[model samples]
Target: MITEDSEFLKGVKEDDNSSFKAIYEKYSRDLFVYAYNIIKEKTVCEDIIQEVFISLWAKRKTTTITSLKPYLFQAVKFQIFNHFRNNKFSREDLTRLNIIDVSMNVSQKLEYSELDQIIRDHVAKLPKRCRHIFVLSRYHHKSNKEIADELEISVQAVKNQISKALAFLRNNLQLEEVAFISLILLQ
Candidate 1:
């Protein structure tokens, strides 16, 4: 018998709504819980799961996904980290709250949420090309060559854009910014 995830994935590949529903029914809770562990916001967790599924559907044609579970998990991890980074959560707050462990006090959790909003606010202000390059590299995990080819630019140009964006963020944001930006670019 075909497994549910594989079947739903097959249906999703064919752009079937029922199959998409099945996918949501099967993974939504688990994915949301995982996201909540990272983001610690019930509302944001729902949004993240929705965004992840929407992204999966949008990229279905070109995504070459073999395993849905791992891909979904990867998406959640990135989204959560992005939530944290975009918020520019202060190091002192991060340390005080022990965000690495989700078993924190409620007040600390609220603080984390506020910080995430701030980070998102600043990231939204980035220049057009810089923002696109950052999003493509960070969110879509595109390589320099792939980004260059897609944008009709030289690989060196792609590299320069990434370097410039990273430098800008590093200068303006905290050290945590370096980790995710590097993780996205170097991956």
Candidate 2:
């Protein structure tokens, strides 16, 4: 937790309205924009933000928040994901939301959408352990050390597994395409 947000979390846990409002004011706009990017619906995005803040306040006392910013963002993400999932979204639509890379332009996002589908198809063929590690490192953005800790494995093993996964992807994808995907995904 950052020192600043830790203070907010402490105050919120003690039912301080000002602390809760401070956190809301700081994050709500950013959260709305983030949700809007994926959802592209202003009303839905606003509702998701409201729901996230409400959930945060409702659970402040019981939830073990290690990082307040990430927890709040993730809550908004969860709501959006569920909204898509429960509304009969196609696999491609979900994939578009699943890879929310704001760095890409409209055309690149379309291109990546097609490319992402291809990569996912190939990634599905990976061994279970390799697939899990790759998803953790690329999709979830977990550090190799963090993944190793969570998986109860050595850092060396994590590195070797990631190497194997990348090698497998390189072999299966366009000879040079995985390089581009890796650059973005590894970020």
Cα lDDT tens digits, model 1, 121-183, are: 555677888778777776565557778999999888887877887666556766554332223
Top lDDT: which candidate number? 2
| Cα shift from native, residue 140, model 2 (Å) | 9.5
lDDT of 2 by residue, 1-187 (tens): 3598899889999999999999999889977876786778999999899899999999998999987776776687668766764587665563344434335599978876777788888888989998898888766646688899999999888888888887777677773345334232331
Instruction: Estimate the overall C-alpha local distance difference test score of candidate 1.
Output: 0.68
The segments of candidate 2 whose C-alpha lies over 4 angstroms from its true place after superposition are 99-187
Pairs that clash in candidate 1: 86-119, 86-120, 87-116, 87-119
TM-scores vs. true structure, each candidate: 0.49, 0.55
lDDT of 2: 0.75
